[model samples]
Target: MKHKRSLLALPYVGWMALFVVAPIVMVVVYAFTTAGFEPTASNFTGMGTYVSIFARSFQLALIATVICLLIGYPISYVMAKEGPGFQRVATVLIMLPMWVNFLLRTYSWMAILENNGLLNQLFDAIGLFDLINGLFGTDLTYFRMIRTQGAVVLGMVYNYLPFMILPIYSVILKLDRSLLEAAQDLGANSAYVFRRVIFPLSLPGVLSGVTMVFVPSVSTFAISRLLGGGTHMMLGDLIEQQFLGGAYNPHLGSAIALVMMLIVIVCMWVMNRFGQGEEQAVVL
Candidate 1:
């Protein structure tokens, strides 16, 4: 049985070695080497020029993650407390957009946010812009919703919100009801029970949702490109430029990618430690 199990693992092991390990090894090698394949640290040292880009990426990602949490947690909690029929419908509605292609979804948002797009058209039809202009004594044609940092954040929130929701919903749904009842029996009110019992227990889910939302939001290129209109270039776009764009520096791109991965790892480690502390406190 042991030998059979070892054989069963061979395919997965090979797959990881080929896909995951190999790519990571290549990235590490490229990150630490020059274009001439000579070992060098300047690839990382030369990233000072892009400090603003890094800051913007993390800032936008954090904002999007916070927004997702604020919106998703309440929805998840409600779904968890609701009936099976409600949960089913809500789950489908949440997941329905995911069935479409990611690019297509983003493109749809681009259309909606453009100067003369559907949203602006609707605003114009309803005289919203006229009202604003009339009140402010200014001439206004259309709102510049697209090609801004706000647009980029909005895209990140829309694309990744479901990731935040599903993990929290699953975790909240699986929470032990007896514990909630015990809290209530101990004279805890709804708010007190949630703060003391529910929220503490949901830390794992919150952390997971945060990770899921933050990682992609920080690394996103297309959304920033399309929605931000080249004004808000993120880390992903910077990396892409090094490897594939006019810059053509794979070594630098790899260095940026490696640093980003390390930063994300450190952030997650810190969050996990915080979550563990919360869980321990709850246990006590």
Candidate 2:
């Protein structure tokens, strides 16, 4: 039976090696070697010049992740409490935008936020721009919303918010009703019940959502490109320039990729440690 089980897993193991392990190995090899196939530390040494890019990416991703958490946690809580039909509809609504292509969704934001786009036109039609100028005694015609860091963060939040919601919702739905009831029976109020019971048990899901949202937000290039209009460069943009853009330095791109992979691993470890600590506290 053990041999049969191992046989059954061979296909999955082979798939991982071919599609996942092999690619990672190739990237590591490229990261450490030069175009002449000689090992060198220059690729990583070059990263020192682009420290600001990594900082900006992490900052924007952090902001977006926080925004998603603030907006999504309440939505997830409400969804968890709703009837099955309502929950289904709410979930579908949350995920509806994901059906469209990611690039298309980002492009749509560009159309909305550009200087001469629908947003400005609507502001003009409603005299909002004039009102703002009148109130402030300035001659501002538009807000210059696109091609900026804020726009990139907005795109990141819009795209990744659903990821934050879904995991928390799943965890909330599986919460032990008896535990909540026991808290209530012990004279715990609504706020107290949630603070003591509900929130504690949902740490795993919160961590999961944070990982899902932060990882993608930190690594995204398309949203930053379309919404930021190449004005701001994130880590993804830097990596892309090295590999696909005029720079055409695959070794440097791989080095950046490896660095990011390490950062992500460290983040996961920290979150795991934090969650375990919280779990122990809750148990006590």
Question: What TM-score goes with each of the models?
Answer: 0.97, 0.98
How much lDDT does each candidate structure score? 0.95, 0.93
Tell me the tens digit of each residue's lDDT in model 1 across 1-284. 99999999999999999999999999999999998999999998988999999999999999999999999999999999999999999999999999999989999999999999999999999999899999999899999999999999999999999999999999999999999999999999999999999998888899999999999999999999989998999999999999889999999999999999999999999999988998887768
Taking the tens digit of each residue's C-alpha lDDT, what string does model 2 give over 131-218?
A: 9888989998888999999999999999999999999999999999999999999999999999989998988889999999999999
For this target, which candidate reaches the highest lDDT against the unseen true structure?
1
**lDDT score at residue 239, model 2, on the 0-100 scale:** 90
Q: After superposing candidate 2, which stretches have Cα over 4 Å from the reference?
A: 282-284
